[model samples]
Target: MSKSESAVLDTRESKELKTPTDLARKGVVEIAEELKHLLADTFVLYIKTKNFHWHMSGPHFRDYHLLLDEHADQIFEITDEIAERARKIGETTLHSIADIAHFQRLKDNSEAFVAPKDMLSELHSDNMQLVKFMRETHEITSKHNDVATTSLLENWIDQAERRAWFLFETLRAH
Candidate 1:
């Protein structure tokens, strides 16, 4: 095939899939993009949480380790839902770790060691940021009248907030 013909075929193949939703195409695209970014951030956060969980040490070793493991599990659980929601809304989901790296807003930690309190503080900040991102995406979903996505985000937001609260309380007790 000629280059131009191949380009046309590629464009056609890359078109967004049709999904049943009341939202306009533009709104669906916007929400999907937001979900993509949120999913990327969640992935980054989950890894960082696991890193802390694995490296935790000190007088409260067991407690901090277990706490981060629970938080990591919660963070990892939402990733599938976020990606599936994007697919359900007629958009392709992230395909690889490079895509996650491109979309992620959270920073990855590579420190040799982080103090236990520092780990809790950093996690608390990241969880709060995730909550903020969810709220922003929730606004977009609400504006588009995408009730299902909005509902899912509401639950995820609550979970993120709970995680943040636990981190905050743990730090406070330290």
Candidate 2:
């Protein structure tokens, strides 16, 4: 290589080239840990929502089924986003039922179908938990100067909180 080229390479190497992931190493680690929790909680919540969507019974079955299905779909999308974010930061997400059970705030319901109000309560609680985790992750991302991830997290938190509020109101109304 020419002397000028070598000098340029040396200068570049000396400068700290940071990507969002690189800048977020510390926050990324914290967020990864939170993602592990959120992944489990959200995934379990997704399954429960799907169950309610499929097996919802009563006068409001159609409306509840469709609505719950929509919520489940949304949660599934967030699940993928959370996993992708974890992968971006070089972290492995929770990957199995057992892992999910260990980490998730939400619980699996296998024995019997629950009442619509009960289902809504469960979903509301899970969504609130997710909101809390996302808010913390947002703060971490802000500190790390990871604007993109922070923005994404803000959106996620907003959506989750909205879902929680909707569910909460539904329960109160019914």
RMSD of each: 5.6, 5.7
> Candidate 1: where are CA atoms >4 Å away?
1-17
Candidate 1 residue pairs in clash (backbone atoms < 3 Å): none
Error of 2 at 73 (Å): 0.5
Tens digit of lDDT per residue, candidate 2, span 1-174? 999777657756877332234554677777778778878878888888898788788887777788788889888998888888777765667778788888886668884868887888888988897788778778876777767778888888888888898888878877
lDDT string, candidate 1, 12-46, tens digits: 78774655566799999999999999999999999
Give TM-scores for every candidate, taking all chains together and pairing residue i with residue i: 0.89, 0.79
- Cα-based lDDT for every prediction: 0.92, 0.78
- Cα error, residue 54 of model 1, in Å, equals 0.4
lDDT of 1 at 39: 98
Give Cα distance to truth, residue 47, candidate 2, Å: 0.8
